[model samples]
Target: MGLFILCFLTTGGALDYLYFDAFTPSGPTLPAATLFSLGAASMITLAAYHGGGSLILGSLGAERPDTQIPEHRELRNIVTEMALASGAAMPQVYVIYDPAPNALATGTNDKNSAICVTTGLLALLDREETQGVVAHEMSHIRNEDILLMTMVSILLGGIAILADLGRRGFYSPRAGQRLGRKTPLLLLPLSLLIGLAPLIGRILSMAVSRQREYLADATAAQYTRNPVGLARALEKIRDAAIPFRGATRGTAHLFFTSPLRRRLENSDSRLAHLLTTHPPINRRIELLYRMAGIMRPPVQNTRNASTRSA
Candidate 1:
């Protein structure tokens, strides 16, 4: 959150210098303009922070699961069970109509949270696996991972918006000459920072997301006492051929796995690893197996023996 605020402030400062200070000859003094810009940016940030959950759900087209439907009923049941197990309030349950198997938790806190699953997740996983998946999401809600990720996402969006504004203002015919004249010493560095802010914010978001995923996995195992179930669900998600059509880079980190069909996650290179939102599926599975005190199972009957043991 601190990092996100810093990026937002940096971008906001650049905008103030480029447009607020440069364009208005009789405007407020430089310090006053800067203060005003920062204050405005802070208000926007707080609003986005508080409302991020609804924004994410709306962006993903998440809808309340119809309890009249059997599958949706079962999904809600599993969510309720997990909620009780985690000592959290019953979160609103939602479903996405995508074919890709994925799930996410969102909201500011446990009482105000939601859990959404793809249609494919319901079709693909049996009751036990579904419980594991729901448990994972529930863990995110309980641990405040939902709040953290939502805020990061909002900040990332803010940085991208401010960066675009800075970029356009710097290159504009009138603003460019004025900016060059007003603060030539700061121009080059500020331009570079604005240009790179989005990438930098994305990297930071991914890094934080990856670590939270591991924590959620462990917490889920604790909640379910069945790490193999989540491990199996993850394996199915990893091998599923269909990608989520609705997923975008901006919302990719919120899912149980990366929803975008990118091969970068499979590479062994350090940079590729750094850029991914989730840790490697195999590594996560191995960690789960370690938690369960069992040897990793073979592919064909991975669930049978491990499920029994767990």
Candidate 2:
């Protein structure tokens, strides 16, 4: 968040580095801290309001039951049943169009939780594979990982805004400019560093932690009673080179698989895993391998449900 603020402030300074300088009123030039405060408040306020609004609008208008796709009923039923069995309430379902296969669950809290799927995901994965993905997302909802994601975003964004503000204060009016010339070069870079702090913080925040994903996987397996289903699904995702389009770094953690296109580099490589929300695919796959043996038969077979209803 600091980085975001810094970037915002620094960039503003870098550009009109002159504009902020004008604000130092005779009384006590607006404290450089105030600019950062403004940035933090401005950016995060936008993120929270915008993020919360989008989720609401998307569900109310775009994901109405009547507008849901034909297969939505069956999918919803399965998920609802699973939730019931798990002692959790049902989450709203949404169908989104995108070429890359993916799904995500989100909400500020459980009561408001919603799940979304990409057209690409629906079209690409086989039935069991799809189940795996949904189950993974369901796990997030059940565990409140969804809420954490939003919390993280708000915090990160706020930090960036502050960082930006600080940068803006560095350069200023004639008086400030005079100070800058006299100040050590160190202060300039320090100001820039302040803005970058948020970005660094974000990379560290990554996912809910590796253990959470494992537990989610376990929960899904328990729900579906089909470790192979999820395992196979993960394999297909790992092997497929097709990209999950329209993914944002902010939302990547929301997906069952990392939304990032599979790169030639190792996920554990410094660049790949540095601050990603997901653990490496290989590690997740290995856990699945362990579960494959103990995977119990599903108490409710979706295939049977589909066939019986069809």
Candidate 3:
């Protein structure tokens, strides 16, 4: 929210400077224009926040899973088990027909939330692994990470919208006249800041998302009492060579794993780490195994250890 306000001020100030001559003595006062911009941005952001989950699910083509299918039925059962274990209300369930293995939870709160998974996930993971994934999502609901993420997504959108408006203002006849009078040195800095605001907001949003994912992994282990199940699930997802066709930059962070796969996601470089949405998959898997008090091993060996631990 603080980030959104800062972006609002920066972008709004740029627009006011370009179009309204905010610094000129005869023009509207800078403080008044700023207040108006802040008010407008807040309303748009609130509306988006209220409808964020539905918008995200609709964009992904998520729909209620057909319970006639055994896999779908099992998914609901696992959701119920995890909900009970975590003491959260049963979230509405939906499925995407995409052939990429991924899942997400979304809503403003526990009572209103929904969980959606891909058909590919049902096909790829066994019962235990499915439960593990479901538990991770349930942890998101129980911890109110859903609300946190929803707010961040909306704020990022708000920044992008403001940036677009700023771009449009630059081309307007009135703005061009005002620009002629303004010092070139003053305009340059404001233009550059407005252009870069969205990129900065995205990097901050991804950092928040990565931290929440780590927390969700730990909470899922506590709920299921089986960290290895989630560890193995992460390993499989990491190795899967499929692209999520429904993914977009705006919605990628909502998924269990990053829907848009990039080679940098696996890189150890600090710059690479900042550019990725989620933490390195291998790092997440290793943490889950550590929670289980076991050294990470090959998939088959981990399976045997999982069985023995169970």
Q: Encode model 3's per-residue lDDT on 1-310: one tens digit a residue.
A: 6776777777887777777778678778555546766986787567656887887788889999897999999999999999999999999999999889999999888988999999999999998898999999999999998987876777777788878887877788777677888879988988887888888888887887888899999999999999999988888877774669988766777889988877667655898679888887778888889889988653433443464589
Give the top-scoring candidate (TM-score).
Answer: 3
Task: Please give the lDDT score for candidate 1.
Answer: 0.81
Clashes of each: 0, 21, 0
TM-score of 2: 0.71
RMSD of each: 5.6, 8.8, 5.5
Residue 63's lDDT within candidate 2 is 51
Least accurate 10 contiguous residues by lDDT in model 3: 298-307
Stretches of candidate 3 off by over 4 Å are 30-36, 173-175, 297-310
Q: Note the residue pairs that clash in candidate 3.
A: none
Please write out the lDDT profile of model 1 over residues 108-153, one tens digit for every residue.
Answer: 9987899999999999999989999999999999988998888777
